[model samples]
Target chain A: MTERQDCASLLVQHLGWIERVAASLSRRNGLSGDEAEDFASWAKAKLVEDDYAVLRKFRGESALTTYLTVVLTMLYRDYRVAQWGRWRPSAAAKRRGPAAVRLETLVYRDGYRWRQAADLMHSRGETDLSEDELGKLLADLPAGSRGRPRQVGEAAMAAITDGADAEAGVHAAEAEQERQALGTALARAMQGLNDEDRAILRMRFWQGYSVADVARAMRLDQKPLYRRIDRLLSRLRTELEKAGISRERVRVLTDEDAA
Target chain B: MKGRIDDAERLAALLEGRVTDGERAALLAELARSDDGLEILGDAAAVTRELEEEDRAAGVLPIRAPRPGARPRLSARTGALLAAGIAGLLLAPLAWRAGRIPQGSYAMNLSRRVAVAGKGLPPGVGSAPRTSVRGADDGLSPGARAVRLGARQVDLHLARIAGDAAAAGAASRDAARLLHAVAGAGTAAAVYERAAAPAGEAVADRDLEAADANAERLAGTAAVRLGAWCEAARFAATRRDAAFFRDTRREVAELAATRGLPSGAGPALGDLRTVLDGGGPVDWAGLRTRLDVLLGAAGG
Candidate 1:
């Protein structure tokens, strides 16, 4: 048989398998019945596109069914992304790697709480970060208007930002300036450390991974990692002191309720 | 370009649970080298699982039937005797559980004889379905029996290597039950060891073909068992069940390096041994793929 004939024959033989796989994909992505049928049709067309380019990619190393499943899955993901526009991670999250980006997407875009996002990530073996760690990682992230929207009325907003009284507004301005100064000092101190030390700090404190997890991921002994983190913290404290940021001031700035 | 194609093939094999230990390790290493690779692995797995669920719901078999022809011939009397013997073996466990047959009694002796007799049967007879009724399988041709057994083995091995403790444990029990049915209370390991031993001389082409097919089947079964144990170890490691992980790892290493296995199985086994001994994180997915490939190659 000619190549086209061969492809057509193969497609006819595996049509049931293809539709089953497509339906499964649609169900997983929460497609309606009509949408699922549409997806199946789209998948069939895509398979025959470019003269069965996707189907022809099979190399016979694995079972024909398995190869087709992987191909169809990739196609399904593409279809979902095109239709739903999956949440894009910010450049900052991207820099932290895929795990961080996924966590951010789950929380900021998908409306999951920090703990829920961390739990999801852990279940998928994507990240081992605790909820607190996930919170810390995104603490400095530029807030997006996706999940947690502030819907204060004009009066409430004015009372809070402008303040009900002038004295209250002045006190708030002073506190904000002090908080920014402390944040700048903390960043400067972090920059003084080596890359590995910085990463260790980030994993331990910023990302909220437990000591054991960080040690395991980095292939370090637990006891040594614990000591190393302490030493790094001391170094950061010394740097902050040099920058005129006192330990007391740092504590107040970092205090959640105080802020 | 070739590398990408090879990786895709490797990924497909991994997804289908058909890779050897070595290929699994290589693919995992490749995936671990980049975030994109990990993302792809996760995505592929997620999709494949959904399809598998659908397959299960539709009552589809995990594996296709054997190719047509190549049936090993057996006399009618022999088929009947084998079927009756296998049926007795299947019920031996229940008899033991019911306290009707004591350990190492008449039932045990009878099972040992049946096991020995079973060795002389066709290559795929070792994997005969546990659900077969007495005299029911006797009516089918040897090729049909082989197909039925092959499908059953695939399903069993897939369950064992499913990466869930409950499922793997249940599969182990089923496998044990099958072995117990055959050996009349013999340990599963003993049967596996006997099966893994070198085959005797075959005088005729037909005998040689049967021996070769049997050897391949045994090897494939061993590879699947190894994969299952490795998967168990991986699950245990995730749960920090050190004892279970250690025990399963040791078992896998021993099985992989068993004597008289095909030379084709050496590289994968060797790689598995190295990984088990490395004292580092085991790439269970990679090891699973490698074993899958070995099983597939063995015609399982």
Candidate 2:
């Protein structure tokens, strides 16, 4: 087929992914039913418009799904930002800083870690603040920011283009089961975490903040922040391993970039 | 700094391109030793990628324009006039060669031209009565054009079914049955999952079961229609009698009315009839797309 046709076909194949991701994002943000459907449809149209020229520009540095996820997430974020006019952490979350510290701004703009947000507070006279203190400051911001896990089951089904094929069917079912198991394990692991560890991990994975952002937010230097992340991952791995999921398997599943 | 950087901060620094060469090497050595460490880094890498994307996307991408030299918008009246002009141009040569318009060729070409012009005409404007095609005053030796048109329409309908042979066959399979043929099992599963979700208002087991049964019925009906429409279209195409196509159209229109499609059914049905009656050339691409979309959405 010609290049244009190939691109169009590729866009069609990934419509499910676009829908799932859009639905996932919309649901996370509390949009439902028709709202969610509209958001997803709009996202699909964007990807498919101009004969899929958007997808045709892919440089192929990362997995196409990951690229799509990133693109959709950014679009969703931008949409919310536009609608609400620049999200800031709750104005009511009292802090020691002279200027109100929006967790998103701290992490996204200044590349500060969650701990660095505390440092910003500490420098303003909230000295010797505990990690829990920092957690309380950012807790009110949102559930999905800074690496909050998205519910992707329906969205994952969108990736299954050929449900009639036995092999694709098995893979889809297995993937669904795996996702459910991981979700359960993740919940259990989160429960085992102290508030500070939970907040840190949430900022790191769920919010998808850079370590530097989290570090800058929480006011810790990069070194201890990295150690904290490694320790948290180790602890989660240990919890999952105890729950009968192997470390190797966890590694494989977490590698979402693997096709 | 020169040795293995065991500290998480140093590794994070190295990942962010803030580390010296020695610190980078040390982190690489540490990652090779610890698989978990590597996994964490991978997670961090994904995070870094998202951050980069966020930075690059200052705002949503701009909308693009349609390609230059795209087809001009032709209104139905304008299109009819243009088609008439083309038909006149082609017919002029034949008329000139005969020293006058030949009776058979003139009638045949006029019928063809009428069909083309009718495509752009509104349904009420130039549409012949449903039964009129059989006795319409076209100069054709009766039923000849109807037969050819029917045959061509049937070929197109058969091809549409052949294109989806796998999905159509699979509709009878367990997985396909799990979802409706149009929505597939994926949509059915979605409906089931939504119904069964415990966090929402408690839906009764009986209600869930009824919904499932309803979904099954819809899927079954749609699947049957998928096959039935193809077969019917094939029959109408080969029957070669204008009356057959007209009657079949009326039959489906009645079915559509009973189902209460409310808006699209009448127009689409009307459009199909117009094409079948040789009002305009069959837009096979447009027909195939419409059929797939309509059948896919068909629950009733």
Candidate 3:
């Protein structure tokens, strides 16, 4: 074969690798099947457009496959940032707070179950996620709590059918208000803590660091560290209670960090 | 500006596990002081996660292994029949050479039966079946084709073993075995070219399977031949039996040359020279283990 023909054959072989990289990028960016195919085709066209200049310039510093992977990854990341640039999360998701996009990506795109995704997120330093908190983020409310309204409706039909609609609306409204108030109180109390204290809280709760790790990192004796942690929780409880958060709500919030 | 760029590079290095202890301490100190430090760490972490995610998505997955108890796609009964057929073909040459079977009857009956059965035709007179017979003068009977292919397989196995032995400096026994197998292969190749020369239709599965068995037997035969040659070479070298070495070398070289073998007298000649000059290191146990592995893979 002539040099051109040999180069063409080499390019043909790399087409499969390029397509695979493009497909991965598409999947990462949550593109549909057709979009993924289009992305792959585009990547192939770009590689070959100027007489395979990109391939010709390959210096053999790394394996051709590895070089292509890094190139494709950078291209894909650039494309995604140019297109989306943190515009993915809606106001509601933003209100749901930090790592919401990551949570969704893990649960939906990566196909991780909620708890596993939550653990991964925490490990990656999004440390505020308690297991129950993560579950709530995924709308995996406690079975009885989420299902209680339906049970109440069934009982209302058996006894107070006429007043059922009004009673149910009032109860749901009250519950929503309480939930919102609890979220606000927690957020405010968390923000009120100094940066060092917040970091300690994260290390202790979010990251699931052992008490020993926390003490070592904080340069405190284990006994003093434990006492300091206890005092911090007590202060949070008082602050939340002042803002009308019930003791039960505070207990629920603190329960996740008991480990 | 330089300090921020340094910090960014340090953070990237930290994520990639290239950060030094002092840099790690500095990065940790920065992280503890402010939210901006935390944001830098989070972004670095996110980039690391993305790279990992891409790798998982794009990495070549391992080929699923063949399950245990996986036999050839051909049934066990079919394999057994093939083995039997190959055994008959292979034995014909040896038996005839030994004067155990009448050559005339063996050739006429076995050839006619193999041809007819192989073509899936009745033994009735038909000119059309004659056209299906590939090599009239030197063409292989169906049985001969099986034997020939099996012999070729044996030759290949011997070559591989010989190569391995040479590599491991166990060249003496392996070289002799290889020379024997090469000669055998030349004969087998000639038999196959004359007897089996690509008849228009695909060779039947039974014939192919029989050939596989024949190849294994041929390899075994080659191994036996190697042992005999090793003994002969050792005797010739140790006793200064120049006449024996001269004769054996000529025979091996002549057969190899006729077969268009690249290493005409190379290995056998080299092994003889080694033994005669001053014996070289021969890892006999290692060579045996290697042969066992090869034979085991070949279903010997």
Candidate 4:
């Protein structure tokens, strides 16, 4: 095959991971998968366009995996900061300065650190921990944690671009199991949403309305439902993404559009 | 080119405030050529998103937090408009065509115009202040052309309950002016530093609709817990405040639990419990050591 075809084949081979990462990023950032892809593509283009020869000087200074993770993370952080720098910490969170960043922020900043926080609290003998367990551990951390951690997870390391999925597939089953556990916890947290928000969620995810359709059905006008969905999903996705569910992995309810 | 820096600064100021359609047309017409101008627009857009995100995260919602310790955000209508504009700009390079600007750059462009246009206006006749009985003012005219054009562009839904196009347009000007006054770098910032600041005081006193009021209130209450708890943590740093700090932490943690939040809030809240339990140092300096251990413990 020609070089172009080879490249196309490689991209196709890894499309699943791209969607996964795209979804995960979207859920983490209160953005859509499409939005996430815009940044992901930007990263890929930068990768292709930049001369990697610059790294030639640092040959053996650190593991290439560590170095690459840093670069990808830095790029992601730049995009995130650029997109939403004005966000202050949550009232509860802000008061805890140098305290742990939000779970989503923690995931973006230090991928597995929040998870570690969760584990720490669990080990401390807290019993009957519920969905809010994630919150407990981070809060328990010492004040002055200052800023999001930059350390990422195995899943994050695997999904920056096209074809990283196959390599990651070897571990997808394990990751999915983790996501399942988090998903259950997330579902439990759903109880807190107000009725209107719950209704909107039901319409979109359960009733299978297009975002536009949901807007129309609500009769009020505009995409209130979509924004609510995005925000609500961002909260849930924070835990789920950290666990392993890629936003791109959404299960389609039907194949009507395919026909 | 003699006025490049001045013009750029002016344009940046305009972008920072709200731009009327007329102001937008004028600004877009002026800066379409320079690469620097485009960069300014892009940077402003990025800054605005960051600002809004920060706003939302800070609990600037229209909803009340049913439970305390929630973050409120922009109303759904406002959110949709802003989100749509953002999504459009990101997806479509077509939005910014040759010599014509994309309309979505509202925060940067519109906010700036409102500020500049209102700069020296008298109090009652402030820039775009209510077109109260703009009776025929809504009609399209070459003179009122810019305003008319913007009126049409304002999505009817979000503004319908708000007021007519003219009224909403007027409010936009006021809101923009206020926002730019605070966000702007010049004298504008100093003047509106406290006045017209967006932060709300009480959840019930907020302008949120019925659906959102509860969630917003919860978040507001939580904000208090967060602030108090955090302050309690900080003040305990010096010589002997262990019991005081522990009691305060417990208060914070229990508050979180009652709201159905994860319960490391107090008494046994978080890694503090671990540190204290293990007989490790419990001072402020020891906080980091305990936090690090928690951060490192992911069941691996």
Candidate 5:
């Protein structure tokens, strides 16, 4: 057979595989059946474009099915990114790995609940993390935007300025000073940590990842990691104390309401 | 960074389930280090699995079916017994070869033996755990030693199958001695459990059952299926015939379901079982590749 005929025959033989790949991508992205069919058609056209350049690249070192799977997946990623702007996962989620990125996308972008996202991830074989673990790892992320940003009304803006009394302004200034002092002390304390220790603290406190999640990510023992966190906390507290931040002051500054 | 050509090939091999244990391990490690690689792998695996499920539902046969009137092959049991006998015969020569090699050359010889057996040394030799001539050598953890010895066992089996009697025999003796040392140090499973355990917590043999139970809950039924698939793949590797692989695949499908696998493994495991039990000429190569990707995800 001629090369074009050979390529055409090959595509015909594996059309089902191509369709399945397109269907899978569509399902993952929550596209409708029509959209899936569209993707499959587009994929086939792309494959046969340039006189079947994609098929010609196959060296036969790996199975044709595998090569095709990888190729189709790459194409799907490009297709999705082109249709919708790129989905950017949070920095913390990215650091935790691909499963975390998928979870974040499902929860934040797709508006799935923690339970639903975890279930989907499990069902799809995308992750092994439990729902509770997923929640802890993602605790630091802000809630997804439920709606578009709206402008503040003049009445609301007036109320905000009108409510700001001199006494309150004075207290706010004092609080801000205290916050700065606390931040400087904490930054200095953090500087003393090695890279891994710093990462542990960042994941645990800053990113709100669970202790177990932190241990798993760092490949450290959970019990020891707990002790290490405690020890690190104590050392930081001491450094803050040395910087003239009292225990009571530190507690007040670190409280949820204070932020 | 964009994936290199070799990365694509490795990913393809992984998806196809044709990689050896060493190749799987090395590829997994590399994937672990790269988010983009991991993302591509996850997508490919999900798509491949879905396709398999669809194929199973439609009762689609493997692309490469056995030819009509193909010569009947040995049963899986008979092939296994033949493999065992061949392995047994290589032991004497392995022992003789072990005696001939100098003690200091054990590490080099082991790598050479693995290469000779047709499985090359794992990528990044500097990063691979160095196996001393004796297990008593300091600085090597029991878990690390177990892994090294495990690789040796696989290499020896491959060598035996490849008919490299000298390499197989030498590997057999080294494996036996290392296994003995490993037993004295600690059971390999316990060593692995300890390594996985959190720091400052002692993992006694008694606690291993509890640990395993916890792991089962965490990993779910898919992990169990993956483990069974790996075992089946190892067995089928010795018997390259289509019929033997089909039988092995069926047996694994049954074992995966009947073993009281937890529900937490969810629809994914169920889908996989359906695919395995589907009536078709088994695409043994494809099944193996898909299992490799699953196994990698399970942190095997």
Candidate 6:
């Protein structure tokens, strides 16, 4: 066979690893294979362009496979950041096509559950997962939290069987949350806490802790406890900057409210 | 800045259970500082609050371990009391074990398993734990300290054939150990728990009721199955294992039986049988190819 065939064969042989890397990036960062393929092709192009000089030296440092894995990973990260910067607004853009568009719509606008499931499956390709396992994971999703709310089990089975284009659906859904992005306000609101305060805040607003229980547990007398709560609110207000959420949104609820 | 107050001392006194009314007032005033300092103090208080909330929510919280600086300051008498408390908590597993039945087939010989499983214990242990070396019974690998805890063909093969009791029982203890090894190799616990259902049945209540008998039964059964597989793998490797499996020897072994056949076929075949039998190298690609061929053949 020709050199091209040899290279192609080698590429085909390691296709699983290459795909695994792609799937992992998709899962972790919600990148599609088009995005994944772009990163990989760029890495390979760079590695091969310079007369195989860097690639040869890389061969000596680690096994060719290991070196390729590292280089591909680094290149993907750098290329992704660069690509991301180049098309900032289009970061949430989904390509045309029923499958891809649907995936993007589901992830971005429909429900966090399908996006999360797809993200997990994408992130963990052939990762000790069986169809049954994925099915079970879908079934176990918070009892009543299906995106379809209309479908369960077999209907949900479409997610996997139709998955050839289902991933396009993931890409589509990813574009949905573009409207309400994680921004500076949320980031700042999260600041100024030692790990403990952060944990408490998480337990409180996010986790929905009640004031009375929190006060009692912290061993604070009510007056002093009220003061601390005030300080937390003030800090949160300063941090939110204008995340559209207000002090009223910062809830400390009883178990009844939590339920 | 305002005059520095030794609130640390006041808090230390409070922590020491000697909080005077005067000291309590002073500590509260200092804790109410604003901006960054207040934030830091608030964070500390909040962390303490979180710890408490975690206690209430979780129903139990890990004890506050004293930092190194505070260690020597602990009164020896208090230290002794603390040590006793530590001992009681540390031995909670022993207390827990005393009351409960061993849950699964792959019972970690507590002492032996602990010696190897350094750090990141299942739930409760006092001492530092580490991943221990695979024992002789755990099976050895070809190279120097090649104690690889990779996926067992048996487990994968059994999991694929769910509801098959014969395969499940013969492979239960081995499958569980394979999972133990896989979990050691960083497989998620959910996978094992799912596998454990079938594995539980494999080594039934009656089997485990007699510990020595159970161990002997598993050891002997695994030895036979593994011996057959291992021997088959070795011979196929040397172009002999396949020979035996086919109920024929090298005298009539096919040309394909020769090692290093084209497309790495013969060697790959060796890999397939090796993995299928007792413990062997993880030739993932070879196994996949074998499956593909078998799948194709069956389809045809």
The number of the candidate with the highest lDDT is: 5
Question: Clashing pairs in model 5?
Answer: A221-B198, A221-B199, B16-B289, B17-B288, B17-B289, B94-B169, B94-B170
Find the number of clashing residue pairs for candidate 5.
7
Where in model 5 is the C-alpha error above 4 Å? A88-142, A145-259, B3-7, B20-26, B60-82, B86-300
Cα lDDT of model 5 by residue, A31-66, tens digit: 544657888888889999999888666544455566
lDDT of 6 by residue, B1-300 (tens): 132222222232333223444553454444333222222232233334443353446433222222212324466699789989998999877886743554422222111111111111111111111123343355432221111111122222222223344333333333344333331322322233344465444433323323322332333322222322322232122211121233322212332243322232244444445555644333323433453342222111
Winner by TM-score: 5
Best by DockQ: 1
lDDT digits (tens) for residues B147-222 of candidate 5: 3444444444344334344444554454444444433323433433342333312333224323222232332333
Select the stronger candidate by lDDT from 3 and 5.
Answer: 5
Q: For residues A1-259, could you state the per-residue lDDT of candidate 2 as single tens digits? A: 4556656755655565456567555534434356567777677777777877666655332234445655565555446555444443322221223123343445533446777766664564534556676676456443433333335477777887764788888999998997788789888987887644665566556544456655533334667777878878878888888887878887764442111
lDDT of 2: 0.43
lDDT of 1 by residue, B187-273 (tens): 332332233233211122232223223422532444434433433332232222333434345555666666544444466557656
TM-scores of chain A in all candidate models: 0.42, 0.38, 0.36, 0.27, 0.45, 0.30
Give one digit per residue, the lDDT tens place, for model 4 in B93-150. 7644623432322112211211111011111121221222232233322212222212
Kindly list the per-residue Cα lDDT of model 2 for residues B1-300, writing each as its tens digit: 123333334444434344444544555555444433443444344443443344336431111111221223467589689989999999776875653322322111112211211011111111111112222234422122222222222222222122322221221122222332234335544544443233312333333333333443444432333223433343222212232243346455554545423233345555555565565333433444444333323311
RMSD of each: 17.9, 27.7, 23.6, 29.4, 22.3, 22.8
Query: Looking at candidate 2, what is the lDDT of residue B2?
Result: 26
lDDT of all the models against the reference? Answer: 0.48, 0.43, 0.43, 0.36, 0.52, 0.36
What is the Å distance of residue A216 in model 3 from its true position? 30
Q: Judge candidate 4 against the unseen true structure and give its global Cα lDDT, from 0 to 1.
A: 0.36
* Stretches > 4 Å off in candidate 6: A1-21, A27-30, A37-76, A82-234, A238-259, B1-100, B103-300
Per-residue lDDT tens digits of candidate 4, residues A44-70?
A: 564344343213222222222222323
Superposed by TM-score, candidate 4 places the C-alpha of residue B10 at a distance from the truth, in angstroms, of: 17
